[model samples]
Target: MTLSYRVLIALLTPLIFIYLWVRGARAPEYRKRWSERLALQTVPVQARDGIVIHCVSVGETVAARGLIEDILRSYPQLPVTLTAMTPTAAELAQKLFADRVYHYYLPIDTRGAMARFIEKFAPRCVLILETELWPNLLAEAKRHGAQVMLVNARLSAKSLRSYQRFSWLLGPIWSALDLVICQHVDSERRFQQLGVARERTVVRGNLKFDCQVPAATTRAAKQWRTELARPILVAASTHQGEDAIILDAFARLIQAVPELLLIIVPRHPERFREVTSAAQQRFSTLTRSSGQTVSASDQVLIGDTMGELLFWYAAADIAFVGGSLIPRGGHNPLEPIATKTPIISGRHVFNFQPLFDRLTDVNGVRLVDDAEQLAEQCLQLLQQPVQGQTMAAVASEEFAAEHGATARVLADIQGLFPPPNGQARTLKMILTSNPNAATEIWFDDNLATAVSDDYFAPSFWRQKGQIIGSATGRASAWFIQHQPQNMLLRHYYRGGLVGKFNRDRFAREAIVKSRAMAEFSLLLQLRELGLPVPQPIAARYQRAPIWGYRADILVAVIADSQDVFKLLLQRSLTAAEWQSVGATIRQLHQAGVYHSDLNCHNIMLDQAGKVWLVDFDKCGFRTEGEWQQANLQRLLRSLLKEQGKAEQSQQLFHWQQTTDWPHLLQGYEQA
Candidate 1:
């Protein structure tokens, strides 16, 4: 799925570039900030744990306002990064949120870009408003342990038909979503058909209906309206073809009401100048961008500003939402409801059909087909203020009825992380394979990728220190410093006759329970049993042909520690130091943890006089007492092996000349 999608996106990038170039010519905003679109901004995306909310444009951004506030109030300590896809929406997000969040332009939905985006943000959960379902974005987000959700989600029938054509591609993507909060039952059913589990799909009311009109914007609207004559009519978010219909209707309405003023606000910034140029040719026009004082003689005003949609809705007595006038579905209808402004739209509001139905039922929205019908409705609404006021009030009431969803949304999000022992909860992940690759992994869910043999590569760590290589050809290890502590990364290998032919591969029997995993488990058990040991960070293995395998494990390096073998050659061991070694071994045997290859090199003592055991490859738990004596015999043989090879010195306790074994035995037997 990723490869297929990548190829399509790659092939279409040139066309996409051309589209952006054409739009950039009209709207410099699109071209001026290329770094933001590519996620190359200087500011860091995010860090620590928090939620990220993605809103596609101004309409969806407004709908997410209440939900964002809810999340902030609930989890005050967590960081928030709000992202937008377009410049207008990004600007509006800053105005609405101010310093409340870290804001950015959402990156292009390619795997590399998405991976970098996810890595930078490191978000614990991601909330996407409405239906911005980018497959690679979701997949990469899940790979990094983000719980993705679609809020105020709706799947239009048109979208459903299109998505069905790529069911195989989309099904897995839909299944990866942690939650789908839909606006209606129809959308919920549609999502279920597209492979969303029923348990994860929820029916939540439209958040747009729950939005409130800003008091500051309303006050500004009143101040702006004082300069204009009575009976102001606004054609808000007018699309290209719809502007012609609106201008025609306004031309007729002006003759019937001489005091009326028409306002045309194009939906996009690029069209502002185009609409302004076209409107100025026939009408006495005033534009917000020109900073001209309004006059009763001025027939039309072009709304060429930003972050003032609600202000325009509040400034007028009636509004015709634009896209409906043409076949372009429709813009959000609920924008005017918050301001108690009457709405007039065309019959083709398929994008907001369900919302239009509810408004029509309450007699709050009037629908018209052509310019003449639109003029007629505007004339009547202006003539009968009482009827128009009643409709506006109902629209605001309809908005209030959907008010409680924010709290409900907050509740469900809170349920995702319950406060337990005053710790931030981590996601639970079971052992699972990467479907895109050929490997398996087990770890805490937050990591971006499964820990595997290749994970030990120096590139994986942020800083790989010096790699110390041993003279022996049996095995290899690297030293690196990651967060929290330094780590030792070692690849497992066999020695002696078996190693000559097999090299790096371990026996096939250990495939199910690989040598690395066995050692990792043994270390965990030893630590749990109160034995001193290095922390086992992660372990993994890759299979070879014939089921043979190579394995690796990363363990925290103990600070200020040296092996007993090195310490022995430095000075003659005191009786207390020898006794401490015995007690350490006694503790391991008493806890039923057996070290299969314990020797002088495997035991270490820190500067503060703490003893630790290391290297548990091919080691595990045992119930019998027979292995205890055998382990001691093995250690005795290892000591003699080292003694025969080393040159004797009076400063060291040579195994041939000392009673060190009797002292060790004395401490072991007494304990």
Candidate 2:
């Protein structure tokens, strides 16, 4: 299927160029940057080893603004390359980001073009917005070992059926996606049906809900409203067929309420003149770009300018989101919802059907079938100001409830690219000084409060009546109820001959290189790689005496779990359970992690039988080599030693060298 796809695309390359040339006749911007579209231009130095984000057009570019800006702020050292398929989206990106991002036209999806693109940019990760799944683009990116993620992804029922029809070609491509951050659960389910693994898909809510309405935009809207002092209806992002219906509705609206003004904004730039002409035939109209004041005689205002859709929604008493009156799947209604403006739309909003349906259920949006219904809904809202205000308030509340998607997305992105090995802090980790003991503490800000020396002391938790339990190991570990979570606190102690003299103190070194700090940092990196390791809460290094320091770490405790050694002593594990344990170890090895001590004592199983590895006292990342196999052999030795002890004690041992080991090896090899 892929071979045939490649051949088909190759044959259509000339026609694609001709289509671009034809489009350039009406929109000349398409004529420029032909080299970029063909992947023939030189790659910018700053863009290498960075991130690439592809937004198909203006709407996607706008939807991705918050995410792109957050990525730039979070990883300033890494450059970002923004690609768009249309001139409008490219122009918007350039205008919004300026030189902070490198802008390029996404090349045509020929194998050669995509290969050149992947080779040139060498992006560490590729983020595709919405449903723009180009097979060659995905293939080349994966071929070069770049993580490919689908951001703000959505799939309508219609789109799902269409994709299913071509499953032979798209199945592998969809299944290969590293992650799909969906806007809705419905989309996630559709993607799963189309072959995306359930574990790889997550519902992050809609990125559009996280869109911010700037204070300056609000002030401008207020000023415009005060000047007009009349009820206004904003028909925003109107498609061709929808504009005629909206204009017809406006004509009826004026007969009942003569003072109401209508502002219509078309979705595409080329239709601005056409929409303006259609509006003028029925009523006195003024264009926004003309710099002419809208008089009482002029009942229609044409919003032909760019980047002011939010402003229009904010200034209106009622907003009718366009594209739904036709089969264009509606523009996003969250903009008006953000501005606290009542919304009306047609029933063909399959693109955002879930959101619209929820809004309709809450009386936040009114669905109209045609010009008559659109006019009736507009007149009702315009005549009854309190009703419109109530709807707006409801919609605003719903919008507010969904506002943290940008932060969630940023958190996930942080997980994708952990900081280099020696960096002191992850993006969410914070450092603070403990004045009591002259200590430095590194903690995850999301989990911990202000850290002090007392946090490491069991006496503090005991005094607070928060200590829950204690475990005896080479040293002692205290488990405590830490406000919102259960945490395990362990004080560092030397083992072997070294432990005889210096049990708790060691030579002073850089705080980040201390045993507690190193393990905490390694756990953070491992978690980012999606490993099943304990979450690091906090790590502290306290100055003890001359040239020495005492270290301690606090980590979240896995609930309802027992060590594999203990579980095995209790009863025999199924072959499937053994296979899962092997797969978990293989996953860690694949991430280039060296577990340092991979023994039965360190491996655990939760209530659900999920495998987890713990105790990273001396573990760190290493280049792939024989060490991975050696780590497995060490586990095997531990199992044999335990079996020998069990035999000597006349106890039942669950593991068999020939049977269990083979299952583990099969899982490891397959994984």
Candidate 3:
């Protein structure tokens, strides 16, 4: 007891002091941003032929415990695991089941852990208790073939009201659940209002009833009743501001029942000191169940320990649940009912609503609107033991009748096993920056794949498939269907801007028309003469525009050739190779197709070193003067951009004039 209280004090002392200090201190401006500290390490676990259950906290775990145990017993051959997000819940689960069930801390819901965990635990079925629906978890689970179900579900009215605020993000996630077993009709209705389809949801009653009430729990209550000299009124699960309300009510009640003793239990154990301090300040005489005594003038008594709540209920004449008076969802009233104790709760009984409604329907519980009414109700109940006993008896009967929901849920799940025959083909489409830099294929059920960061650069792939390359940003190349298919995917800004200067205002419409005109005109002229050029199979210029409206161009692959630049840059060219290369260029220019901004990288070479003009988006008519000079200048600029020396480039220009250029002009003028 000392160690627990000390631990509580150690945990809460700083929080209380910090709260007080901050309240009095000048505060900094509030910023609307997520702090980096909030990130969680989410890990995914793979469960092959195993049942994976997620229960958030103590209450959900307790309710789901029976169902988990039943599955283990029924399917002895199958493996099962449980995951919890909180330390206390994990500790409780560990203590409850020990080594009987596999227990692990649930990783934060993040892309990395989620993918890895799914790969680790290829669960056959995933049972999520209550309303702990996380978006990434749900989506990943569905992607990995795990059938998901929410069992023993209950959505409070307050929670439902809050869900309405985020319905857009919440709706699709809720819809993803394959099945939801609600604890009450009201809970089912609330879920439906939040967009949970009725077809997927069914009411299975609260599983808490299915749990066997401990014998010693009842005996301890009897012992408490025998030990208390005065009539005891229990204020259970009270919040911070609520203890004062309970004290105000108790002050009034003590006037009527002079021997009245107030037993106050806080909702969170960490608040024990704050509650006890308040109690000490209010009462002249107070006593704790741990044997600390106070004078009769004292009005408040703190029941701060856990695993003693049942004993407190047994010792009390009437129980008032907290949070209801303060607008927070009322704490569980079932605890008091399970011990055959009469209950008086405030109007905000949203938490244990279904149980409260059942109790009210059977005259098993009393509801008070405020502190005054609570005091009056407690006075009346304490004065008349017969009335309290009758109500307590009714509550016990209702608790017993509501049992078996766990068994029903388990039985239904049993029939859902052995999934339909036949497996479908796995086809995955991943949206990533670059396909070349990827380490491994993202073909896992969880879609756990990564792309390389290097593919995000701009200038590296603008030129390809030609001996003379064009540095027209408007025409770029990429791998399509994972092959080197030159495409004008994103022309200028969108694709059709003619100059780098006009990139800011590039239009998709102009790009499409220009690309089609250039490619088609070249194709028609080349095919007429029966010269070598890639046959244009199909073309699309007015489809799928980018930032601007420019559309991308795609073409089919041509076979049996090496790009001329790759062939020529490596070795000495033969006479036949030189003839074919020079002849192709002459035929193209004579055919009135002069490639604007042509550099060596733009031409393709067959095994025989035959050259072909490609990347027609920058090709222009072979007219005299500045248009021809501009094309030559653009070609020189591209060569310089590749770090070619001014002297070698001058030699390439000299070759263009004396050899290839004159030959091309002779061939063209003669033709």
Selected candidate, larger lDDT, 1 vs 2? 2
What ranges in model 2 sit over 4 Å off?
157-161, 291-297, 419-671
Per-candidate clash tally: 0, 0, 30
**Candidate 1: tens digits of C-alpha lDDT, residues 269-326:** 8899889888888789889878888887888999888777888899999988888978
Report model 3's TM-score to 2 decimal places: 0.49
- Cα lDDT, model 1, residue 386: 87
Alpha-carbon TM-score of each model against the true structure: 0.64, 0.61, 0.49
Error of 3 at 617 (Å): 52
Tens-digit per-residue lDDT, 1-671, candidate 3: 12343344346544644553463332211111112112232222112336778898767776776687787777654457788754446656776677666666555454444655555555668888888876656767777667888888888888888888765543367767888889889999998887778888888887877755467767776776566557888898788778878878878887888778888887765567777877777665454646865345556678755445667776777888788887787877777777778988887887666667888899998888777988989988888899999999988887787778988888667666642222211111112121332111111222122323222223434233332232343454543222343322223343344554554333443321345434543453354456565544323233233433322333334444655445534543454555555566656655556676466566667654456666675564554445544554564455345434535565332233344444433433454
Q: Give a tens-digit lDDT track for model 2, residues 467-510.
A: 98887778889999975669999999988899998898888875
The 0-to-1 C-alpha lDDT of every candidate, in the order given, reads 0.76, 0.86, 0.61
| Each model's Cα RMSD | 12.9, 14.4, 20.6
Q: In terms of TM-score, which candidate is stronger, 1 or 3? A: 1
Candidate 1 ranges with C-alpha deviation above 4 Å? 36-38, 45-49, 227-229, 398-400, 417-671
Worst 10 residues of 2 by lDDT: 419-428
C-alpha-based local distance difference test score of model 2: 0.86
- For model 3, the stretches where C-alpha displacement exceeds 4 angstroms are 1-50, 68-105, 116-124, 154-176, 184-200, 208-212, 227-230, 252-260, 284-301, 350-362, 369-372, 397-401, 417-671
